[model samples]
Structures are given as structure tokens and as C-alpha cells.
Target: MLHIVACIKQVPDTKIIKMNPKTNTMDRASAPAILNPYDAHAVEEAVRIKKRYGGIVSVLTMGPPPAVKAIKKCIEIGADEGYMISDRRFAGADTLATSYALTKALDKIQKIKPVDLILCGKMTIDGDTGQVGPGIARRLDIPPLTSVKKVEAVNQEEGHIIVHRKIEDGYEVIQSSLPCLLSVEKEINEVPYSSFPNMVKAARYEPHIWSVDELEDVNIKQLGLKGSPTIVAKVWAPPKPEGGKIFEGTPKDQVDQILSVILEKNELFQAKGGY
Candidate 1:
């Protein structure tokens, strides 16, 4: 049976998050935390693949204890198992450090059951760097196929898979050997509402929780903030745009009103020597 592992994360809902004006940084408290949207799609796709070919879909994540909620969310989406590596040392990790830590956890999982395929979201909504997936692929020395829009086939006996990779104009069909990593696009699959049975299972699920110590061959210097090298010079929210005027009238009248407003603005600009 295929053992597919999908990497996931719990992130602050960016849509509802607010920025701190004084610190010019995100006010994480202002928003509720949820499973990363892109990662959800990745988990959904993995579950779909498992349904197509007989296999177990497992999800892995790294975060605080509360992140177990994210794992439960994955279970609600039909994942067979969930693993989370949580520890205080993993706090404040940048993408590079995060990848290093996850790789160690993956090594332990591999020992338990040989992984046939690894799937990841194209990018996390909070970070948007889209680096960790490729970073893990590089560390494992496996082929990383990114921007995958479709999984055409997974030939287990032949030990190969075919996928449609999204390109500028359209998509390109590419085939790769097994044990490859795919960073999938959201369009690859539609995530449906969780089934009642899955929801019941998720409610009672308790994922395997591991600390940094549980992972084998871990580098203490590469676990968290201490290991991160990327320096964020500053973080600020874009200035709110000025409110717009409402042109209330028929189409022809609105057109005339718009032209009049444009002329008025032009005259003011000329008066102010704005050319």
C-alpha cells in the first residue's frame, strides 16, 4: 500500500488578521488560528489519491500544542493519521530552520513506514515564501515538482507518476519516479465539506505528538530562532486607500459626471503646477 505524507501548518487567518500600527507587525491575536488554506488543499489531494489507490494518508506538522487542532482538521478531511512535532525550541522559526526541523521528523516517520510520495501546498498563506517544500526535497535529494495542477496517474508497480504542472499559458504533462515531492496548486482539487463519519472520527482523534527530543539526529542549533538567518528589516501594512466617491445617476449622466470630475481634478492639478 502507498504511504503518502502531506506536510501541513496552522497559521493565523490572514484575512481577518490586523497589523499593529505601533510595531508595524502583524497582530496575531487579532485573528483566530486555523489550518493553512493551501495546506488543506494538499491534505485533501492526498486523501483523494489514497482513495484512488489503496494507501494510507498521513499528515505531518510542526507547531505548538494548539496546532493539534490543525491535525484534527486534517482528520476531518479524511486523513488516516496525523503527526505533530511540538516543542518550545521550535518557536520563531524561519523557513530555512523550519525545513531542517521537519526533515528530522520525516526521517523518523520514514523509519516507521517507507514513504512512497510526499505532498505539500504550493505555499503557506502566512509566509507566502513557498520555500519549505522545495527545501525539504533538496535536503532529501528527491525530485520536487512544483505548481502541479493535476495528478494524472500514480503507477505503483512501475514506480512512477504523471502530473500536469501549471505553466504561464497552460499546463505541462510531466512524469517522474516514485518518492518525488509535489507542491500542488489549489486548482488541483476542490476540497468538499467533511463527511459526518470523518467529523466523528476527527472529534475523537488524538494525533501522535513528538517533541524535538523524540526526533532522531536533530541539530540543536537548527531548531528555531537561533538557527534562523533571515533578518526581517521591517514589516508594515500598506496605507489604507482614500475612500472613493459614489457616482449615483443613469449611465449617461454618470459618464458626464465622471468627465466633469476629471476636468475639475485636472484644473486643480494645473493650478498646483502638477502638469
Candidate 2:
């Protein structure tokens, strides 16, 4: 049976997030965290693929102790097993360090059983950079594809996979070998409702937690904040724009006034039938 693992993350519920003006960081305690919306779609797609092809769908996440809940969310979404890599040493990780830690954990997961495919969301809302999926692929020396919109086909015996990739203005179809990583977009799949049994399993499931020492060839210089090259030198809330003039009039009068003002600003708008 094919072994598929999906990487997921937990992020602060950004809709209700509070920011710290002093440190210019998120006020995490003020907001409830949830499984990343995009990761949820990735897990859903992996589960669907397993259901069709017959395989196990496992999830792995690296975060603080609270991140275990994100793994459980994957279980609730129909994953069979979940792995969590939590440690103080993993704190303040940027994409580079985060992928390093994830690569170490994935190495452990592969040792027990060879993984056929690794799935990930295109990007995390908090980080905004969709680099971790490809980063993990780089560390593992596996082929990685990003912006996947559809899994056109999979051939386990011949070791082939075909997928549609999202691109500006259109899409592209590409084929690659197996044991590959795919970073998928949300439009690729719909997350289904979790079965009761799966919900129970997820609630009771304990993930395989690993520490810094557990990694095979981990370099302390590249495992956490120290290993990360990027840093948030400064941060602040978006500055509100200056006050604006509000125009009020009937629909026709308003249009005329607006056009007059616009034409006044730009002389090019004076021509008839001109945009």
C-alpha cells in the first residue's frame, strides 16, 4: 500500500488576532489557534487519494506543545497516524530552520516505513512564504512540485505521478517520478466532514514526538532561531491613510461630479468615449 504523509500547521486565528505594539509581535494568547485552512485542504486531498488507491494517510507537524492539536485535527479529517515534533529548541524557527527540523522528523518517519508521497499546503497565512515544502524536499533530496491544482494521475508500479500546476493566467500539466513532494493550492480539493470513529481516534492519538537529540545529523547551528538566517528586525501595524473627501449626491449627479473631478485631475480623460 502507498504511504502518504501530509504536513500541517496550526496558526493563530488571524481574523481575531491582537498585536503587541511594544514588541511588534502577535498576541497569541488573545487569539484561539486552528488548523491552518490551507493545510486542511492538503490533508483532505491525501485522505481522498488514500481512499481511492488504498493506503494510509498520516500527518506531521512541528510546533509547540499546543500544535499537537493540529495533528489531532488531521486525524479528525481521516488520517491514520500523526506525528508531532515539539521542543523548546524548535522555538523561533524561520522557514529554513523549520524545514530542517521537519526534515529530521520526516527522516524518522521514513525509517519506520518508506513514504511514497509528501503533501503540503501552498503556503501558511502567518509565514506567507511557501518555501518550507520545497525546503524539506531539498533536505531529503527528493523532487518537489509547488502550486499543484490537480492530481491528474498516479502510477505506483511505474513510479509516476501527473499533476496540474497553477500559474499566472493559466495552468500547466507536469509529470514526475514517485517519492516526490507536492505543495497544493486550496482549490485542488474540498475538505470533508470527519467520521465519528476518526474523530475519536484523533482525540486519543498521541504523536511521535522528537527532540533535538533524536535527529540523526542535526547541527545545533541550524535547528532553531540560531540556525535561521532571517529575523524580524522591526514590525508595526499598517498605517491608516489620511482622511479622504466623501462625496454625496444622487446616482446621476454623483457620476457627473466624479467624472468632472477625475477629468479635472487628468486631462487625458477629456476625450469623448475615453476610459
Candidate 3:
């Protein structure tokens, strides 16, 4: 049976998240944590592929203990198994260090079960760089098919898969070899509501959690903050746009008011020789 692994992450709900005025950083505690939306689609696509081709789907993540919640959420989406690597050493990792750490975990997973294909979301909500997926593929020396919007076919026998990759104006069809990695677009599939049985399984599920030590041949210097070279100099919220004047009157009066405002601006411009 084919073994497909999907990479996922738990991120704070960005829409509801707030920024700390003092620190000028994200206030993670202000919002609830949830599965990354793009990664959810990746997991859903993996499940669909399994249902179509008759294989096992596994999900992997690198995060803290609370990330187990994200793994369980994947289970509810129909993933067969989940794995997580969590530790303080992995804290404050940028994309480079993160991909390095995850690549190590993936190596372990590949040894346990030969993975036919690897799947990932286009980007994470927290870090929208969309670099980790391609970075992992590069480290593994495999082809990275990014912006995948549709999985046309998975010809396991032929050891190749066909997919539609999104482009600027339209999408293009491409065929890639097996063991390749895909960074899928959100439009790839619509994730449905979780089934009752899946929900039950998710509630009772406990994923395989590993620390940095559990991974084999890990380079200590390349694990976390020590490995990260990129530095965030500063962060601040954008100034809110000035509010427009409200015209409280009938349609004719509102139109007249707008015309008057336009004429006033035009006169000001003319005064400044802006004919």
C-alpha cells in the first residue's frame, strides 16, 4: 500500500488574533489556536487520494505539545496516523531551521515506511513565506511541485503523478515522478465536515510525540534560534486610514454634498497650480 505523508501546523487564528501594543508582536494568547487552513486542505487532499488509490495517510508536524491538538484535528479529517516532534530546542526556529528539523523527522518516517508522496500547504497563516515545503524537498533532493490545485492522477504503478499547477493567468498540467513533494493550493479541494466516527477517534487519539533527541543524526546548532540567521528588526501595526466624511441626507442632497466636496478639492488643486 502507498504511504502518503502530509505536513501540517497549528497556528493562532490570525483573524481573531491581536497585536501587543507594547511589544509590537503577536498576542497569541488573545486568540485560540487552530490548524493552519492551508494544511487542512493538504490533509483533506491526502485523505481523498487514499480513498481513491487505497493507501494509508499519515500526518506530520513540528511544534509544541499543544500542537497535538492540531494532529487530532487531522485525525478527525480522516488521517490514519500522526507524528509530532516537539521540544524547547525547536523554539524560535525560522523557515530554514524549521525545514532542517522537519527534514530530519521525515528521514525517520521514510525509514519506517517508504513514503510514495509528500504533501504540504502552499503556506502557513502565521508565516506566509511558503518556503519550508520547497526547502524540505530540496534537502531530500526530490522534485517540488508547488501551487498544485488538482491531483489528476496517481499512477503508482508507473511511479508518476499528474497534477494541475496554478499559474498567474491560468493553471498548467504537469506530471511528476513519485516521491516528489507538493505544496497544494487551497482550491485543490473543499474540506467537508468531519464524520461522527472520525470525530470519536480524534477525541481519543494520541499522536506519537518525539523530542529533538528522538530524531536521529540531528545537528545541535541547526535546531532552533541558534540556527536562525534572519532577524526581525521591528514590527508595528499599520496606521488606520482616515475616515471619510458621512453625508446624512436624501439622495439629491448626498449627491450635491459629494459634488461640493469634489469642487472644493478641485479649487484647492487649482490654487496649487494643479490644473
Candidate 4:
């Protein structure tokens, strides 16, 4: 059977998140955490592939203890197993450090059962850098396919997968060998509602939790904040723009004001095919 691992994350629901002014850090307690939206799609895609190709789908993540909520979510989505790597040392990890920790866990998972493929979201909403997927693939010495829009075909016997990778203008079809990493777009698949049985299973799901000490071949210097070279210098919200000026007076005056403003930026209009 094919073996697929979907790497997912629990992210603060940024839609309702608030920022702390004193420390410039997110007030995570103010917002509920949920599985990363794009990662949800990645899990959905992995489940679909398993249904089509016959595989064991395992979802993996690195976060605090509460991150098990995200793993159970993958179980509801049809993943057969879930694993989490959590420890105090993993706190304040940048993408590089985060990827290092994840790669170590993945290596350990590989020892249990060789992985045929790995899946991930295009990017985390919180980070938005889209680097960790490729970083993990690099560490594993596998090809990295990013921004995948669809899976065109998978030939297990031939040991290859074809995908539509989104580009600036359109998408390109890429055929990659097995043991590859894919960072998928949200548009790749629509997640189905969990079945009642799956819901029950998710509720009772117990994920394998590993700490830094439990992971094999871990370097003390590469497990967390100490391993991160990049540091946030500062963070602050951008200044809000001034309110728009009201065009009052006559209808003709308003029309003239609009025309004058348009004329001032005539080049922009021309660039957009305006007369």
C-alpha cells in the first residue's frame, strides 16, 4: 500500500485574532485555534489519493499539546494515524528551526514505515512565507513541488505523480517521482464533511506525541529558538489611511472633481486598457 504523510498545523484563527500592543505578539487566547485552512485541503487531497490508490494516510504536526486538536481533525478527514512533536524547546521557532524539528520527526516516522509521499499546505496563514514545505523536502533530499492546484494522475506501479502547479500566468504540469513533497493550494480539493463514524473516531483518537528528547538524532542547537537565525526586529500595525474627502456642492462640481482625479492618474487607466 502507498504511504502518505500530511503535515498540518493548528493556527490561530486570524479572522478573530487580536494583537497585544505591549509585546507586539498575537493575543492567541483571544482567538480560537483551528486546523490551518490550506492544510485542511492538503489532508483532503491525501484522503482522496488514499481512496483511489489504497494507502495509509498519516498526518503529522509540531506544536504544543493543544495541537492534538489539529491532528484529530485530520483523523476526521480520513487519516489513519496522527503524530505530534511538542516540547518547550520548540517554542519561538522560526520556519528554519520549525522545519528542522519536523524533519527529525519525519525521519523517525520513516523508520517505523517508509513514507512514499508527503503533503503540506502552500503556506501557513500566520507565516505566509511558504518556505517550510520546500525546506523539509530539501532536508529529505526529495523533489519539492509547490503551489500545486491539482493532482492529474498517480501511477504507483511506475512510482510517479503528475500535478498541476500554479504559476503567475497559468499552471504547469509536473511529473515527480515518489518520496516527493507537495505544498498544495486551497483550490486543489474541497474537504467533505466528516462522517458520523469518523467524528466518533476523531473524538477517541489518540495521537502519538513525541518530545525533543524522544526524537532521534536531534541536535540540541537545532531544536528551537536557539537554532533560529532570523529574529523579528519589530512588529507594528500599519498606519490607517485618512478618510476619503467628500465631494460636496453641485453635481457638475462632483463630476469635475472625479474627472480631475482620474486625469491625474491617467497613466494607470491607460495601463489597464482605459481610453
Q: Using lDDT as the measure, which candidate wins?
A: 3
What is the C-alpha lDDT profile of model 1 across 20-55, one tens digit per residue? 889888999999999998889999999999999989
When 2 and 3 are scored with lDDT, the better candidate is: 3
Best by TM-score: 4
Candidate 4 weakest ten by summed lDDT: 231-240
Q: Is candidate 3 or candidate 4 better by lDDT?
A: 3
Model 2 Cα shift for residue 69 (angstroms): 0.6
TM-score of 3: 0.90
Whichever of 1 and 2 has more lDDT, that candidate is 1
lDDT of 4 by residue, 115-161 (tens): 99999999998888899999999999999999999998889889899
- Model 2 lDDT, full chain set: 0.90
Q: Each candidate's lDDT (Cα)?
A: 0.94, 0.90, 0.95, 0.93
Better of 3 and 4 by TM-score: 4
lDDT of 3 by residue, 134-252 (tens): 99999999999999999999999999999999999999999999999999999999999999999999999999888988999999899799999986766676898999899978999
Q: Write the per-residue lDDT of candidate 2 for residues 49-167, one digit (tens) a residue.
A: 89888889889998888899999899899988998888888899999999989988888899989999999999997778999999999988889999999998888999989999999
> In model 2, which regions exceed 4 Å deviation?
239-256, 259-275
TM-score of 1: 0.89
205 in model 2: Cα distance from truth in Å?
Answer: 1.2
Q: List the residue pairs that clash in candidate 3.
A: none
